[model samples]
Target: MTGLFADDSEQIDRRTSRWIRDAVGERLQQCLRPESRLPTHLEQLMSELKKRDPEDDSH
Candidate 1:
């Protein structure tokens, strides 16, 4: 009975892990789509920063 429970538990854990991985992969695909763009405010801020210190390649 103990060994049976262990096997069942492992199977449940594997299914749960696979489900999480699939969900995260779907979310990542949505976030990384080519149509994704930075917000306008952030883009402006980055442009200003680059103009302020164009030589700052330390980042």
Candidate 2:
């Protein structure tokens, strides 16, 4: 109870916390590419899922 959780969490959360949340939101929009016409800027996002495991799919 006094390792990674007790230490580093706060520092990491403050520094790169936005990255995780942004990735989650961006990934969600990527999943909808097949059903909707995505904007040009989203081209990479639409294809991002290919990098993840097909069996581990999560929305």
Candidate 3:
């Protein structure tokens, strides 16, 4: 029946969503650990951005 198929589809969607949430949570936890460091390129970019800019107001 269509109802049975819909129920199965909903269950599958829920399981998939839960799995994705768990995976992302684990990855975020890993990233939040003390040992994590910003990538070199991003660090360089941030350093450049921190330099004085005449047009910037938040100095």
TM-score of each: 0.36, 0.33, 0.36
Model 3: CA > 4 A from native: 1-12, 34-59
In model 1, which runs have C-alpha deviations exceeding 4 angstroms? 1-12, 34-59
Window of ten residues with lowest summed lDDT in model 1: 9-18
- Tens digit of lDDT per residue, candidate 2, span 1-59? 46766765457542254456458767867887667866777657645643442432454
**Candidate 3 clashing pairs, residues 3+ apart or interchain:** none
* Deviation in Å, model 1, residue 48 alpha carbon: 40
Q: How far in Å is the alpha carbon of 3 misplaced in model 3?
A: 28
lDDT of 2 at 18: 46
Give the Cα lDDT of each candidate: 0.60, 0.58, 0.57
Q: In candidate 3, residue 8 scores what lDDT?
A: 57
Residue 22 in candidate 1 has what lDDT? Answer: 52
